[model samples]
Target: MTTTLTTPTTTGPSRARRVAALARGETRLLLRNRTAVVNSVLLPLLLVAAVPAMDLGGDVPLGPQLLSTAVGVTLVFLTYYNLVSTYVARREDLVLQRMRTGELTAPEVLLGTAVPSLLISLGQVVVVAVGVAVLGEWSAPVEYLLPLVAVLLGTAVMTVLAAASTLFTRTPESAQITTLPLMVATTSLSGLLYPISSFPDWLSTVARLLPVTPVIELLQLGLAGRTWDGEVVDAGGAWAAAPLPLAVLAGWLVIGGVAARGFRWAPRR
Candidate 1:
């Protein structure tokens, strides 16, 4: 006679317990690593402090501009760059593969691993927001709430992007090279170093299509309580008015979801 055997299903606390244990383990690993800690925290702090000294002045208030810039930088470095590096490192270490055999689902494993990074990012944002509000004299307009939404959406997109990027990264150390293209391109084009309005027409058109552009536009609009009304054109000279930054942000979320669907917890052959 042939016999069938099935694995037992995990119960509520079993799932929660697995997530909690993973969170603790990941947190300890992150905190113990000096380079990771500095990259995650110190770098963002320096950028936030340095932006005000550059004297990029205009009709836009310093408060909103600094706040927007600070938050944007934080989102990129903390959520995007840090998460990608960490995920690659863990996968190379077989941490991700081991976790998959536990009670956690793929989504749960990803989220659980990400919890520590997310908490650190959120803490940094809060601290920077307070500092900007006090020293930079930043008071966000009521409409600025919309940009906060964009900031959040941007973080989610960044997380998924990190996951997808891992497929190309074979080792933790190689992540720096793999991540550079997106990081440099997004940082330059996303209005981190310069305002998008100042870009040449052709460059601006291309920049608008990059994921970071919409997030930055949303931040600028939220801080200033305005929207982008400029023309966006493709190479063929087919032009359309820029959609509301909010709409652009929502679209990115959809794209991130699609990208995330293909992310693998185990290495692909």
Candidate 2:
């Protein structure tokens, strides 16, 4: 009998599938880390709760300010700090190095590792938004798209910045120290805890350029439909208010990406 030649076809998981699988695994690991879980889950809500207690002393509406604080804190501590620790831990364990030799590409590996944190941050922000609407008696956002765009781009910016942070973090424990500068800058200068409007004009201008400031600004504008200077804007006006912050975020994405290019996947010498 003549034998016919046969070819085999191989199929692999899609990029989304791959990332999801990695994210699931990461979630399991993250759950085991009590500190990470507490920080990611509890700290942000607590901080947001504390926001109303602060003598915020401003004309800005409390509801939108609370929402912005929740999102900014989540992005900072949950996504950015947690990802920095995860990246360093994975690199130290050679997990990143081994993954690099597999079918997963560099960007895939980074994004996959970051997926859990990103998802958690987004979910928490949604929860906070609902809480703001219900318990805080907040109205629906006039410019929903601005806050949505802010959160999406803000996540991307934080992810890249997290990857960049790992370049300085030698170990997971060291992430606390290495993460501080951005943390300080974001919390203090980004107007998350204070109004940039209260700053001197030049300082206010500079604060607007910080990485997380635009995201907070966008959220404020979207939720309150009011600019920093107390100008009321309709939905269409929100689009006009977006270009500067969007450009600033885009610029930071570039800066963070360039820095992350030098990230070490292997254990440090």
Candidate 3:
């Protein structure tokens, strides 16, 4: 008599289980990395607090400027830097590749990885907003709620952009170099250091076209109770100083989506 051996089949983890596992692992990794933790959390808080004291020497209220500055820093540290570093580390370690082979879809893996960072950012925003409101006497109008939406949308766009950028990054060390262009360009053009309105006409025109411009405008408008009067005109002239936050953000979303589709989880063969 001949006996045949049966191979056992393994089932993948549930969606919830996979997400939880991914989040836990990512959190642990983030905690162990001292520089990542400091850059992601501590530096942003310091910048937010420090900006209010800076001598802009302008008539603008410190509250509004601080709010805008805080938002910019949050986006940079939480979304852009965090995503780039995390993606690079995961890619180099084959975590992304392993996740892709599991039950988790590409979108699921990306979203799952971003969940922890998103939570951290949301918490930071709450703390900063409360502190500013109490210390800076900030009183935003109800209609200004739109800027919060812009922040959320912008963060999502940046997260996807980070993932797309990682396709070109081979290791975590290279992420620092690859991220410089985006960090510098966005920080300068996004009104982090100074208001774009103060820039030269030509420079302001270029700033408006950048990805972070609309978000900053939205935040400033919300915080300052300013109206969009069509003063700033883009090359297309379609935005026209309007609350084009949704439109501009949607454009970035589309670009990021296309890039994500083209992104590779593993090194090219």
Candidate 2 residue runs with Cα over 4 Å from true position: 1-13, 44-55
* lDDT top scorer: 2
Q: Residues 146-261, candidate 3: write the lDDT tens digits.
A: 56776877888888788778777777778888888988988987776766667888898777767777777776565554433224222223223444666787888888877777
Per-model TM against the reference:
0.82, 0.90, 0.82
CA lDDT, every model vs. true structure: 0.68, 0.81, 0.68
Tens-digit per-residue lDDT, 45-162, candidate 2: 6655665575554566888877888888888888899899999999999998888767666777888899888888887887777666656648788887899899999999999899
Q: For each candidate, how many residue pairs have backbone atoms clashing (under 3 Å)?
A: 0, 0, 0
**Which residue pairs in model 3 clash with each other?**
none
User: What is the overall TM-score of model 1 with all chains considered together?
Assistant: 0.82
Give lDDT tens digits, candidate 1, residues 14-52.
878777888998899888988877766775477567655
As for candidate 2, its clashing pairs are: none
Task: Compare the candidates by TM-score and give the number of the best one.
Answer: 2
Report lDDT (Cα) of residue 221, candidate 3. Answer: 61
Q: How many backbone clashes are present in model 1?
A: 0
Off by over 4 Å in 3: 1-17, 57-60, 227-242
